[model samples]
Target: MTDTSSKPILILGGTGKTGRRLAERLTAKDVPVRIGSRSGSPRFDWEVPATWGLAMQGVGAIYISYYPDIAVPGAAETVGAFARLAVANGVTRLVLLSGRGETEAQRAEEMVKASGADWTILRCAWFSQNFSEGFLVESLLGGEVALPVGNVGEPFIDADDIADAAFVALTEPGHVGQLYELTGPRLLSFADAVAEIAKAAGRDIRYIKVSHDEFAAAMAAHELPPEITWLLNELFTEVLDGRNEALTDGVQRVLGRAPKDFSAYANETAATGIWSN
Candidate 1:
């Protein structure tokens, strides 16, 4: 048996959504953890290859949550290179957080598989935390969340569930070579989601549909950085085109329970007072 007790689990993007939650869970279980992020100790930046070696040292497994989106150009090459490097450095396990319906992300998955490491792929849909903890939080706080989406429903999974599944993949057996498509129990349009938040938050919030060009112009008018604006535009125009409207049972298959509902998520998050301001 591999002596995993002495080896720390490396969590890339460890300060971000899923990675942070995973790190917390592992720590509670007394599993050694090394955070791999630009701000983490030893400073691991995906753009800086020199930091990877130090971060990978003494790491037995890795939970990889790529910054930005994996659908961007050159992401597959970078993932492939990183996977090869991990294997060369004796890292044995990898759990990749990927995107649903992204061809480029699928390519990156293949690279991890070919790298000779025990790997599990979590191809996830949009996250429910986007409203409470991510880019959409600002729009939610503004009362009117406007976007280019037009009645397209997305099965948004909870970040906590993703973390749970990732923990099992990292520490447990029998998950190697598995590709799990994780999604919520049902689908909800952006408008439906906002309405649920409004109900839960006891406030009036509106969801406005706009043309892609108009949305881009609004982002520019807000003086958002060009790179972020371009990425959001691509996500709205390309990724949210009803390609991932269906729900999946990956969470149930992996965790053996129904994934949490959006209403439950909205209610719990609203109670936290994050949407109040």
Candidate 2:
């Protein structure tokens, strides 16, 4: 059995959305945090096996937030190998940031579960930050957010809520062997979400519905890498096929509070001036 009492917590993607927030929260609580990223001190790269052991040194727990996404090809194998390595390096706890309604992500989740580490899976919905902090931000700035989506509603969870849940899972003892399907308090269509942002930002933003092929062509025209274009296309088509329309009690279950609504996210993010040019 691994002794986690004094070991530093390893957070992969420590500078990313949820990872960054979790790291901040943990650090504020005086928890020893080892950021694991290609650019971090004692760099940890998911594609480079040679760097794993160094980051794993004295790490009692790990937050696995795969880059690109876990739904991409070969994510399961890579995550599985990493989990095994964590066990070998004396890491006893694993918290995986996963995607809801993704078969590939589920496969990766299974690999983490079987890794012999005390595991907690945070299977989450589309992030509310996607508008302000991610790929859609440029579109929001341009006043037009076009996508290959229609009336399908998604329960967009706040990344902060995800970070909070992860913090609990990593530090608390009751979360082991639990799978938390995190979602927002309410569901909103892509168009509805844009409208909320527009209302919050006091701007005119149009939500244009384009065909999947057309969206792909536009992304390619913008010179996005082929892999990224492919991943976006897959997520827009397959993952958003009305599969994750309902709200889950993950936030309430884990944190004993209702998840933040999209309106709150939009309002708070609008204050940051991310939507304004």
TM per candidate comes to: 0.97, 0.98
Worst 10 residues of 2 by lDDT: 1-10
lDDT of each: 0.90, 0.91
Candidate 2 backbone clash number: 0
All predictions: root-mean-square deviation over Cα?
Answer: 1.2, 1.3
Error of 2 at 180 (Å): 0.3
* Tens digits of per-residue lDDT for model 2, 136-211: 9999999999999999999999999999999988887799899999999988999999999999999999999999
**Model 2 deviation from the true structure expressed as Cα RMSD, one decimal place:** 1.3
What is residue 248's positional error in candidate 2, in angstroms?
Answer: 1.0
